[model samples]
Target: PSVQDCTICMERLSAPSGYKGPQPAVKPDLVGKLVKCGHVFHLHCLVAMYNNGNKDGSLQCPTCKTIYGVKTGTQPPGKMEYHIIPHALPGHSDCKTIRIIYNIPPGVQGPEHPNPGKSFTARGFPRHCYLPDSEKGRKVLKLLLVAWDRRLIFAIGTSSTTGESDTVIWNEIHHKTEFGSNLTGHGYPDINYLDNVLAELAAQGITEESLAQEKD
Candidate 1:
């Protein structure tokens, strides 16, 4: 087998893996392969990676980004409610609006968050997000539902907008919270909002490919 350097430590596969992570040392490090992706890493490095994550029993191969199990998120406790509204967005006048209501209250952080026991800010409650109730929009909604189930919609960390730490913030995906207006630039009437959000979702490893793979 052709040996590759450990991506985490930059050491040869044959060399004993080094320890430079946050975990305490106990045993000598060895190497192993992620059975699905065939990506190799030091066993210690893999354990460190897992420990640094949500510890949700799923791991992504760092090299290929292949997921071994369901990917959970660092979103705090919240409620995701959705319903159809009678109003139509600017660009899509043919269909009604699908309103998503995300309600997360201020609470202490858990082990999944950055600082456990520290209070996190929930700047907005019942934040309204919008989408068209069309075929493609419904498809996006379905995937977003999956994203919600995996808690990928929001996360607890530093707020980029306010630069506040220990706060509830949106993840990499963006949402169009404005409806029936585009004055704020966050509103619709732009023709590419749905496609853009879909691309953002894909960046987070949520896409039609994941939906197709779910059936298998």
Candidate 2:
């Protein structure tokens, strides 16, 4: 009798010994069900095969074959991340906000642009760089971001820290600049500046989870 081919696609696995780790024995009823082969193939492997050429239902499985499912192409989900340093001033509620402004075109102000003026509406989680009513904490936050990421720093409110860059008084900077941002329309500052900042965060693997509240 001719040997039957394993439905599971194991061609990708170069080594055959103990292949795909320890896969559970296939169920007897699953035999000849057109299952996918691999070091470790899932039951759903068959679904992909069933729908491979399907326009309406494009999915197939290694076993039981040709599962009817809708075609799903990869799509990018646009998201921005940031940490918030809440109001540094007392009795003031600094609406935590983060913005992602583009260096070029369509400006981030087309109603949906994550501009800093309304930082609260930007993202649900903003990192508190420094605690309110604490001089030491604010200094610490300023130091942390600047020291760790090599990012230039600035701030709004009624204080200043003499970093390599001047402690830009936000209001004064605002009056001088186009957005009254003095720094960049609040936290916006220079387009290149923000782009670099966000890029730095990306490099550090700053994801949605980075916005969690600090436990101090």
Candidate 3:
């Protein structure tokens, strides 16, 4: 069977890898197949791609986005708590609300952090976030639990708002912090919040499809 081009470097599988980094010691024509997706790519290209990333011992297929190993993050230790709230959010009056609370305290950074041995400030302890208990919202919650398990919810870095170094910040995933209004631009009334959050979660490699793949 003829293998398609390597999506990572956009080169035919039979040819040498297009990776221009320090050359890997494998045969130029050697290719590797992803176990789950069965996609083949030049071994050298895969090595370069993995090196260019966080190198957290995981590989994601560029063609099908299948994750090969557990994906983790450099988020400092924290607590994630969630429960059902009786009151409904402004725009989601049809169902009850699910509130998630994240609590991370000030701590020294580790080797994986941006600055090891430096103190990182967690500005908001027990930050509150919300979502409706609808079907899609529950789906998002399930995926969110996975994200938290992988430590992808928060990270240690400089605060974009205060410009303070060695601080904790939200890691890409958007949350609605405001309870009643959209005043802070983080609140509700936006029809696309659920879908938008799903997209954000997918961008972090925490999609529902990936979750199912893990189960398999």
The prediction achieving the highest TM-score against the true structure is 1
**Candidate 3 to truth, TM:** 0.77
Clashes of 2: 39
Query: Mind giving the per-residue lDDT tens digits that candidate 3 earns over 1-216?
Result: 135787877778878778777776776677888888888888888988887767899988888777778777888888999999998898899999999999999999998888889888999788999999999989999999889988899988878899988999989899999988999899988899999999888877888776796589
Best by lDDT: 3
Higher-scoring candidate on lDDT, 2 or 3: 3
User: Candidate 2: RMSD over Cα atoms?
Assistant: 20.0
Q: Report the number of clashing residue pairs per model.
A: 0, 39, 0
Cα lDDT over the full model 3: 0.86
- TM per candidate: 0.84, 0.18, 0.77
Candidate 3 — worst ten consecutive residues by lDDT sum? 1-10
The list of candidate 2 runs beyond 4 A from truth reads 10-29, 32-58, 61-67, 78-216
Q: Which stretches of candidate 1 lie above 4 Å from their native place?
A: 1-3, 22-29, 183-185, 202-216
Instruction: Please list all clashing residue pairs in model 1, or write none if there are none.
Output: none
* lDDT per residue as tens, model 2, 36-93: 3222333333333343332334443434433323222211122222344342222224
Q: Name the better of 1 and 2 by TM-score.
A: 1
